[model samples]
Target: MYTTVELVRGSSKLADEKAMSAADVEMYIKKAQARIDARLKKRYRVPLAEPVPDIIESIATDFAAGFAIEKYYSQRPGKEEPYLAEVLIKRAEADLAEVLEEHLLDGLPGVEFLPPPGPAPAVLARPAMQSTTPVRSEMTAALERW
Candidate 1:
């Protein structure tokens, strides 16, 4: 996983472990990593191998934390300020979109970009026939008979 449960806890507003269970946090992190992989697979080989890029880790943390807070938090009735969760998710998504559209992973180590899969070349599927029998015209047939 790009981000860990600890990182998600640190990045989010969950002050006490009581607020959100460790298993829930871990689940969020895994989901966040999967989401990242889905988004990045079009450009790079994903689940991203080991020693993942720092930016990717950060984005995953943000996503996981946001998801946890947005889903599990119980006090959304009268809060006036925007939830940190929303901000984190929006920023992470924007960054991820930029990474996808702008070729941001071009020079990073361990990052493999996939060439766009396109249509197959227009070519005959079968081999050319060799030693074909010559077409015999009516005149040629008559001559042959003669």
Candidate 2:
């Protein structure tokens, strides 16, 4: 049995590391939901009061985590950095999905599953030379005119 701390810690680590892909993130979400469902199924054994909040909360947490990871990686030096950031984002996404699944499995009404968000685009992919080229050319032209 996976402890909540294990799940949260793993998820956070993955997000911070950005080591996951878009598809992997989606799969993580699904797996989390399944885990939550199985747990609730065993625990409640009856319908829930309302599942929508749980679902929404779960999704929100994942999105928030994704955003945070993306923001962090945006400031990093290169695209070649290990994909730890991606992993962290996926973990967040999974957490959200799991919460939703738990509520739904509890028999709460009006619960809906949300799709996992896409991975953050590669910011470090920008050519390092692109920005420098224009400035270099401008300086050269200026020097020629001088």
Candidate 3:
């Protein structure tokens, strides 16, 4: 379960808005949770109840922050509004979608194996000659009579 502070601080940085009150942050998060839940249910197998996974909460936090910030900007437009930032809420949503999509990829069939640690062993071959054999030094002479 997200407390007032969790919802606010978790997403404030991403929203780039520090002036919003905790109440405002909480209000937006609660409003955004329904949409987040629906999206999560469609995209992942995770439960949407309280005590949500960190990853889900993370993206939800981002979404909540963006929702609140956009509302804030709409209500009070300014030159430094987050809506004008290059990394907008859409980028965050896209990144989160990619992250969640990985869970689906994890179960797919063709998993690759790592290569062997060291170099491959060398192969040895024997001489191909039919009658040729190497001679070894060994004393095998018989004694001769005088």
Candidate 4:
């Protein structure tokens, strides 16, 4: 899994909320991991191996915490304006999308390897041009005539 239940609890108010059980939190965490994996599988190996990237863990924790909070809301609805859980989920999703879309995981473990950036292309100087005619002398003669 990208993140642990403890991590999910720590990142959000899951530990403070009494509505969700440890098992329920774990379930939500697992689902969040699966969702993260499904989206990242295109560029990284699902269930990412040990030493998972910090960003991945962060993303997973946000997703899990958001899910658990949503579950809590379902069980005990509240009038709290601006649901924080939805914000968490949206932020996590956007972060993950950016990682994939920008190829940000190129060198990270469990991700498809990418070649290092090459040096900047060489700049070629244009050849200097020279006039075949003796324009200086011609101009001098013209000025004299004028």
Instruction: Assess every candidate by TM-score.
Output: 0.73, 0.27, 0.50, 0.68
Instruction: Give the Å shift of residue 96 in candidate 3.
Output: 3.3
Pick by TM-score: 1 or 3, better one: 1
Q: How accurate is candidate 3 locally (lDDT)?
A: 0.54
> Which candidate order results from sorting by lDDT in descending order?
1, 4, 3, 2
Model with the higher lDDT, candidate 1 or 2: 1
Cα lDDT tens digits for candidate 3, 5-111: 46645555533446667777777677556655555555444334455555546656666767766766666657465653224457657756775567632433332
Model 2, 1-146: lDDT tens per residue?
11232233344455433454544545444554454455444444322234434553454334434443454457777763236546645664566456545544443454333345667667865656545453567777789998
Query: RMSD, each candidate, Å?
Result: 9.7, 19.4, 19.1, 12.2
lDDT of 1 by residue, 52-146 (tens): 88888889999999888887664577432237778989988998888788887777888877777877665655567664567757886799988
lDDT of 4 by residue, 27-74 (tens): 888888888878876656567778888888889899988887777676
**Residue 76 in candidate 3, Cα distance off native in Å:** 3.4
Deviating ranges (above 4 Å) for candidate 3: 1-4, 7-10, 13-21, 43-50, 84-88, 104-146
Where is the poorest 10-residue window by lDDT in model 4?
A: 73-82
Name the regions of candidate 4 deviating beyond 4 angstroms.
Answer: 16-18, 112-146
Clashing pairs in 4: none
Lowest lDDT block of 10, candidate 1: 73-82
Pick by lDDT: 2 or 4, better one: 4
Residue 79 alpha-carbon offset, candidate 3, angstroms: 3.4
